[model samples]
Target: MINAYATLASLVAFAQDRLKNEEKGATAVEYGLMVGLIAVVIIGVVATLGGQLAELFASVSEELPAVTTTTTTGG
Candidate 1:
């Protein structure tokens, strides 16, 4: 029973040491942060341009002439 407890303890300690030395999770977190920043920038750009585009289309529509139609029948 004592030997078994010692082995378990050693294994636990080894696992803790490995976890402390690992960098894979940190890199993934960095990548996630970069992607988040890119998304924020994209949202900002769209918000800035959306109003300008709407105004441009509104002006163009105002400049265009209105359409009218007349129908005539001959007997």
Candidate 2:
């Protein structure tokens, strides 16, 4: 009976250690998935808005005045 109990305890301990390691790996995988999803969302938004944003900047630039600069040399 005592030997059986010892064997069971060792098995439980081994399983716990393995589960801890697996949890770490699972957490890393979850973070990677989240980053991938965020990247996809950013790409989609940029694709959807790129043309409209370019037109907006072009219109703004057309409305702005050009600047002239003069440089003087000092002795």
Q: List model 1 lDDT by residue over 1-75, tens digit each.
A: 355456546655655675799734345654565566567656767787999989999987776543212222321
TM-score of each: 0.38, 0.48
Per-residue CA lDDT of model 2 for 1-75, tens digit only, reads: 355456546655655685788554335654565566567667767888999999999987776543212222221
lDDT of 1 at 66: 38
Could you say which candidate leads in TM-score?
A: 2
Looking at model 2, the pairs that clash are none
User: Against the true structure, whose lDDT is highest?
Assistant: 2
What are the lDDT scores of the predictions, listed in order?
Answer: 0.61, 0.62
> Any runs in candidate 1 off by more than 4 Å, and if so which?
1-26, 56-75
Model 2, clash count?
0
